[model samples]
Target: MKAATAVAVVVAVAVTLGMVATLAEAGDNNRVFQPCADAKIQRGDGFTFGIAFSTRESFFFNQTQLSPCDRRLSLASGANAQLALFRPKVDEISLLTVNTTSYPAVTNGGFMVAFAGRKYAARSLPAFVSNSSYTVTSFTLVLEFQKGTLQNLYWKRDGCASCSGKSNFVCLNKQECAIKTSNCKSANQGGSVDCSIGIQLAFSGTDKHDAVLNSWYEVSNLQQYSLYGLYSNLRNSLTSQYNKIF
Candidate 1:
């Protein structure tokens, strides 16, 4: 009986490793990772982008706070229900703005960058505090490409440009314009404030055609939510099956 039990354990471990290897090998094909179907995009084309949110402490990678492209890695404590994704048509230098869904409350908040492939994820950014002191609402995401393939994603600060003249805002280190969380809180104990984060998207470098790309745009005209549902469904399905193997 002991030998049989040992054999069973070994088989289980082998199966788990095999599953992980299979998933990793298939990672690039995952819709959540490559939503454009590996289509060659150019100026005037659109692609899906990802924003992963979690506690500030979880944003670190190798001691650097940057975004992670792997959804599994970006998850906080193995799961983060608060992920924002969008598809923007970037044709010219413009500002693409996106606001995340509201959270019930915040203790420590931050965000990591993610994009169309498994290879790209910028450093994470901190947005909220545990004391509810302030929240950084405005941000810029710069997409850098090398000869049409994406290479890196960067976070840019506005030096408090938008927060200027706002009574409820503050500037950190002459950059990072932040809104006071105190004003966001309601008198009710359950009131949620400073929960939303806004990000602006911009592009640089060239597409496959080597055409100079635009910088920013608004998220109003972009596609969202629907594709995310499909992504979530696929992810859940895979996870459910994997868990059952145990």
Candidate 2:
């Protein structure tokens, strides 16, 4: 791939998979798209966030098709939640849970992004993951900020799906830096969301979700408490709910 094209692939992957938009990807570019309309949305409703059993991030990567975010994160968030609730464990294993239906699965017991299983509600609560056997050792509960009309999302991946390893080869020269990205695609199609007008505004803001994954791996960052930065939004929600009851 050429330099700019290579950069686009990287940024595009980051755009779809990682929640936060890499500063490099948010260049002097813009997307001119015809707004999406939905059956549940009233004509006057400027932005429509279609809720369902779950969200599939697969189409998010198809920049050409017009799905927001990619098969990366938000797509997996819904199915991960289902896995958390159904088997509600945290151990590691093989089968990766993904969404089978589009976002409109709201009527059904949350769409089965992947696998045939039970259902759950997507309350404004935080996100979490568990083992197929039953445990919460590494539970990741992300609280959504319903503050913005824009739909921010969470995605999940099966720990045992065999993630690609980062192989740092000994490249003798700079010209040999043609390393390939994971280039994974979401395993779904169709279903569209009607986002409101305000827009993330900046197109590419700090809302990137790589922080969520990094936290999962127990990495450190410029923020003080790990929860303070990437998870502040979710932690606050937990605190608010706690204060209300106790």
| Most lDDT-accurate candidate | 1
Q: List the global CA lDDT of all models.
A: 0.43, 0.20
Compose the digit string of candidate 2's lDDT tens values, residues 1-246.
111111111101111111332222323121211112211111111121222223233222444322222223344333332221111111111111122222212212212221110121122222221111111111122212222112333333223211124232112122111111111111232212110000011111112222111222322211111222332232232222222322
Over 4 Å off, model 1: 1-39, 61-67, 71-81, 93-101, 105-108, 119-131, 185-195, 216-246
- The true-structure Cα RMSD of candidate 1 reads 14.5
RMSD of each: 14.5, 19.7
Worst 10 contiguous positions by lDDT, candidate 1: 6-15
Q: What would the TM-scores of all predictions be?
A: 0.58, 0.17
| Stretches of model 2 off by over 4 angstroms after superposition | 1-19, 22-225, 229-236
Model 2, residue 124: what's the lDDT? 25
lDDT digits (tens) for residues 1-246 of candidate 1: 111111111110001111211222322322333332233456655555555445655556667654444333434443432444445553432233223223423223443444445444333345543245665654556677655666666676556654467565578779676655554433322333322333445677787779877553332234321122232232332212222332
Looking at model 2, residue 41 earns an lDDT score of 15
